[model samples]
Target: MPRIRSLFNPSGKMDKLVFVDSTKYGNHTRRAPRPGLKKGEPALKRQFSRTKYLNDLAGELNSAFRGIWPAKKSDLYQKMLKRFRKEPENRRGLLLMQLKSMEINPRYTFNSLGTCSTTVKELEESVSVGLQVQAHPPRGKYDANTYYYEVILFTWDDPNDTAFWSRQYSDWIRIGKDYPNPVFEFLFPKPSGTTLQWLLCLRVHLGVEDVVFPVLTTTGMQITDVGTFDKDEIRILEQRKQEEEKAKKKAKAAVDDIVRVKAKNQQ
Candidate 1:
């Protein structure tokens, strides 16, 4: 094969000559055109099937979270396809695991501003999402008062049934003051299936001279089997309670022994 340094023809074809673009060689010529695969070949069928499945899964994810953050849609699509391709056997499980920790913005995380603890509870009629945010005062910016924050609660029983709730705080957090904890209860019917997932998004905004730029970060979790979830939570609480009681008894015994020793010494 001969490499073409500069070609007048952009199409890479002129009558009998055929040109190919290769990363290794800028533009090269092949002696004869390679034979194309037959229409019903097994290898070709498998390739097509795999591509279709991955594309469908990616499309479903994009549709589920459509319009939540338009700027990152393309990146999200590519990432989902890459992940599905990597684990062909367990695409759905792997994708859900990956989404739990996926960062919306690579530059900064939501925890940088403050700390947030999220809890999801499954009620008989609805799901309750409780968020406790401890926001810190502005740093690095001279005008701290111009900074504000927003919180968005996103939940879905199934991909088709999704909900979003948002709240904005105009006042900046001051030192030695408490940031209000917000609890948003989403009225979503219990999933017929066993699992539910929710995503919490935090955005920080800086306004200067009427120009505003927002930084976003998101974290989410999946709850499978409501019965199992409640049981585990109750078990954990009971264990902690038992441990605390044991510690209190030990401390009281030590105090009583110390008092007896002091009395004996004085006598």
Candidate 2:
């Protein structure tokens, strides 16, 4: 027999759902702007990504009982429209601040110490005398040339916090007579003070170090290390493997003794 089921649902309404063909049936390509551009688009559209939805909302609010409702600019709806055009910033603008320092302050001191280094033989001679790679027409963009210098870093914080890192300016850059030293600068889009402090402390005690850039951030002072890992991590792995090998040998020897005793008993 043919299936006999209700044409309507239990709610006594027609069991209906609007089915949409998600696959393009018509000119869907004309709906959006060209990639990588918002040129010549409406200003409101440029401001808000959901321009279509926002416009629809505005239309719905205005269409209420046309004569019964009054049109006024000072209304709450207008205020909402203004917000739609441009949003306000949060009280706390950003968590991280970028660094900026065309010049390094040699007098600057932190964590109870100060130091510098470079590729030039003369710079590494003493703790105080750091060799600034003279602008022998330093190569690269704006001829910025700097070398890496590694060191140990240590740090702590109140209550709870992550560690910081710091390393020597990787190399030196050519500066005018006005600026005496080749200032070791930092990277951009820097971390917050809390984060930077954690990074700077890395220089105090890590096998490898970073070249940090001083940056100004929404979250306050920050330093970004420009260093890589060191050989110490590799040495650690080797030590662990040796310990495992020793344990394995001890287990094998015990198993051999058990086998030998069983053979003797059989004899």
Candidate 3:
């Protein structure tokens, strides 16, 4: 073990050497040679292929939903990798299912708060997603009088496409003597491609005064049906375009409001 006392002593990697910082034993340096895969080895090639696919998928997912993940980025990535490894034959399908059911916050599940039901409808030129949430009685410390929920929608027509369409709805739902049932509807143009998959997530928030904070222990997520449509049938409705613009503005405003609140509190 060697101590790193200089301004730039390296704490990650430098060519053939790797550096690590350990609290108990101090800084350590070791030789970690990068291994290259040889040609014609089918078994090793398959392993490498799987590893790369998983890594790329995990990285994309983490990047796409950076601020929304319930757990640490590394932990979530490792969990997805482990689950995918268990069913190597059905990695894509398994990964989608796992993500659909993942809780943003494990300590307080969305189901504990209420019942959520979703419906998907495929029309001639567009697809519609409807979400219905029915509130339940307050349980434990989650009994906030003024709490709201937000829905996140992510859609991609092509698996290879790096850009995707996203929209979020952040409406406050006040809990009263009678539990309220809030319904949300989202519409997206049918992709010109052969297939389109959309991921939808529900997040609950607690409102204190003018500050709104996410509930770190709830989970509500689902992957909608993948639809196939003819390229000729693709058309974006003007109303849908307006709705998307509105959603984007609302999302930005929500983020800005949270930032302002945090800054005010710090002051």
For every candidate, C-alpha RMSD to the true structure in Å: 13.6, 22.9, 20.7
Clashes of each: 0, 36, 1
- Candidate 3 local lDDT, 1-267, one digit each (tens): 965565654588888888977667667899885566353479878878878877776676667666665443346667656656755442343345446566544455555665667776666676677877655425346445555556665555665654354555546666665756778777756556333555566655555432554655433332332232323222333444689999999999998887433566675
Best by TM-score: 3
Residues 154-249, candidate 2: write the lDDT tens digits.
222221333232234334232234544444433312233221121121121111122323321100111222111223433544675899999999
Q: Report the poorest 10 consecutive residues by lDDT, candidate 1.
A: 218-227
Cα TM-score per model: 0.46, 0.18, 0.58
Q: lDDT: which candidate is best?
A: 3
- Where does candidate 1 clash, by residue pair? none
Candidate 3 Cα lDDT to native? 0.58
Candidates 1 and 2 compared by TM-score, better number = 1
Model 1 residue runs over 4 Å out of place are: 1-50, 63-66, 86-93, 134-142, 145-267
Model 1: lDDT equals: 0.49
The Cα local distance difference test for each model comes to 0.49, 0.30, 0.58
